[model samples]
Each structure stands twice: as C-alpha cells, then as structure tokens.
Target: MNWMDSLFHELQTIPEVAGLAAADDTGTYIAGMNIDDTDEFAALLTFIGRSGLALEEHLGLDPLVYTSLSGKKIKLIVHRILDYFVGIRLSEKSSISKVEGRINSIVGNLDIEDE
Candidate 1:
C-alpha cells in the first residue's frame, strides 16, 4: 500500500481512533473512515489547519505541528502534512499524549513528501 494508505491504516489501528479524514489545500476529502459528512469535515479540517498556520506566521512562532480539540463527546487531533490536513478522531477516554507520541513516531520515520 501507499504511504498515505499505510498512514491511515496505522492511525485506525489505534483503539481510540474512531475515524480519520484527510483534506487537500482546496478542502476536498481525500480519504477517511467512519466520517458522517466527509465534504464538510474536509472543509472544516482545511480551514482549521490553514488558520493554525496563519496564526503561527502572524505570531512569528515555529511551524504548527498539530492541534487538538476536545468537546463533550470526542477529541480531535489535526496534523498539517505539507499540502494536506489529516484529522484523527479519538474517544473521550483516549490518552492524547500517548496517541500523539505514537503518531509522531510513525510519521517521523517516513518521508512525508514521498507520498
């Protein structure tokens, strides 16, 4: 399988990851699972990712690695990979630190631009 496919599969293997979706710079749904409205989700992910990048630029901070959002029922972790935005949805009880570390290890070992 391709790297993106492998990445998605690995992310889903995490027990707490309920679903994941990816979006391009244009906010188009590229891939995912268990997502109710992929188009909308893609748009949202793109918007949030771009906003984070812009915020970091405006503040003269380092590039944004990821962002997390926690709501009443679920938690979402969004990663900006080149021109793509990947959103990983987690169960409320999931350990964000552990998951993020795992994700970091998986992604760090691969050449993201090769995908």
Candidate 2:
C-alpha cells in the first residue's frame, strides 16, 4: 500500500487513533484540541519524529523532508498522531459541537492533493 494508506490502516488499530484518521469534521476537531495541550503536543512531536525516523531508515534516506516520499509518510503519521490526541479530548459530548465547527473550518481550506 502507499504510505498514506498504510499509515491510515495502522491508525485504525486504536479506537482513538482510528477516529482521527477519518479526517472528517469530528476527526479534525479532535486533532486540533489535542495539539492545544502542552503534554500531548510534546508526546505527539516525539511520536512523529520516531515514526519519521523509522520510515527514513526503512527507505534508506539520508535526510527527511515532507516533499520526499518517505517524508510524506512521516507527515501523514504526524497528522494521525494529532488526530489521536484530539480524539481523546473529544470523549465528552459537550465539546463535540464546538470542536466539530473548528475542525470543519480548518480542514475546509486544506488542499489534499489526490493520491
């Protein structure tokens, strides 16, 4: 599978993680909220860096950047990490509407190039 698809599939293994990979309004809200938490944000950055390093090692790349195919994989992994964090924050129904609205606005402008 392509990197994005593989990353998405792996994310689906965790309930919280899966919700984020949906990339819908709900998912975006969860991601946004997760990033707002200092501890969660730090953990997320660490996870992304580790995932990126793994991908780079597997692909035998000397340097990683988002434009590179391996780097794209890293980017997707980071996105999912953010989503997972947001999903945890969204466990409460009370935050759903506001989170969904914010996520919708943010993701709406994102240009997801066709894979």
Candidate 3:
C-alpha cells in the first residue's frame, strides 16, 4: 500500500478508533477508511471546520485549531492544518484525550504539516 494508506492504517490502530478521513481546505476528499459515502462525509467535515473558523473570526478569538463532535454511537475529532483537515472517528466509550493524543501524533507525521 501507499504511504497515505499506511498512514490511515496507522491511525486506526489506535484503540477505539473506528474510521479516519482527510479533506482539502475546500472540503474535497483526499483519503479515508471505514466510512460509507466518504465524499459526502468529508465535505460535511470541511464545512464544519470552515464554520468553526468563521465563528472564531466573528468572535475575535484565537485561531480555531481543533473540533470535536460526539454522539451516543460515535465521536468525530477534527484537526485543521492550514488548508487541510483530518478527522478521526471514535467509539463513544473511547477516551477523548487518548484519541486526541493519537491523532496529534498522526497529524504531525502527515507530510502536509500545519502552517
């Protein structure tokens, strides 16, 4: 498999992780795993990130860097890296701090890097 695929695999090895997805700054899909309707989901994630930034700008707060959405079944963790985004899906029972730590490492390893 390619490096991107390998990265996705590595991210999933984290306990309680259910899926992973990457999207461009514009919300276009880059890569993903274990997600049905990947494109739609990626686009939705992009919108959420963009909206968060808008909220930050409107409120004159620090630059928004991360986001989290949780449900009874799953939780979505999103990281913004300049013009790109990475999202990790985790089980509701998972420790968010643990998952975020794993995602931070994976995001650091991504070639895109954050600006």
Candidate 4:
C-alpha cells in the first residue's frame, strides 16, 4: 500500500482517532472541517514522527526502508502537519514571536553546515 494508505490504516488502529481517510475528498473539503481537532490527525502525526525517529536509531536496519526518499517524504509531511498545529496553538496562545523563534530554530538546526 501507498504511504497515504498506510497512514490511514495506522490512524484506524488508534481508537481515539476520528476522521475519514485522506482519500475522502468530500469529508476533507467540507467547510471548516476542523481536521486539527480530529484525533486522527494528531495521532497519525505523532506516530509517523516517533516511528521515523525510532527507525533512524537502529543500526543495520535497511537503509532502503527507513532512509529512502519515501521515508523522508513521510517525515516531511509529518513536519508540515506539526507546523500547522504549531501555528494553530500559537494563534490560540497569541505567541507569534515564540512560534517564529521555533521555526528559526528548526531551520537552523536542520540546515546543512559547511564542512
């Protein structure tokens, strides 16, 4: 199965998760659908982030499985979801400067350094 399908399946296993599959454009497109509030979104993001990190920790694991472009794409997608949630949380807390600092930190930490 594709990553999106795997994501949906993983979400389904979590009892707290709620929401249609990503393929459900009708459900996803509804006005103010509140995907943020849906437990599935939160759970799925957490799962992907944690699993990716775990995979990275294991030596001799198949690089093709965990370090491939597909794997990085999954991580990037999770990061984007986290960034979205961070924005919403910051809005609620009225902490734009705090969020900006966090984004800066993330970028600075991840940016390639000169050898």
lDDT of 2 by residue, 1-115 (tens): 1433444344344333213322322223222222334444445544555566578899998754321112321212232322232222223222333344444343333444533
Residue ranges of candidate 4 with Cα displaced over 4 Å: 1-37, 60-76, 80-115
Tens digits of per-residue lDDT, candidate 1, 16-64, equal 8888999998999998999999999999899989999899999999989
Please state the error at residue 99 of candidate 1 in Å.
2.1
RMSD of model 2 against the true structure:
14.0
Q: If scored against the real structure, what TM-score would every candidate get?
A: 0.89, 0.28, 0.78, 0.28
The models' CA-based lDDT, in order, is 0.85, 0.36, 0.80, 0.32
Candidate 3 Cα deviation (angstroms), residue 57: 0.7
Q: Write the per-residue lDDT of candidate 3 for residues 1-115, one digit (tens) a residue.
A: 2555656777877878888888988778988888888898899789889889999999999988789887786688888865667788887788787678777788677674322
Error of 3 at 84 (Å): 1.2
Candidate 4's residue-wise lDDT over 3-113, tens digit each?
A: 333334433443322232221211222111225544554455445545555666775454212111123212112232212211112123233333444433442344233
TM-score of 1: 0.89
What are the RMSD figures for all models against the true structure?
1.7, 14.0, 3.1, 16.0
User: In candidate 4, which residue pairs get closer than 3 Å at backbone N, Cα or C atoms, i.e. clash?
Assistant: none
Assess candidate 4 and give its lDDT. Answer: 0.32
> Which candidate ranks first by TM-score, i.e. highest?
1
Best lDDT goes to which candidate? 1
Model 1: colliding residue pairs: none
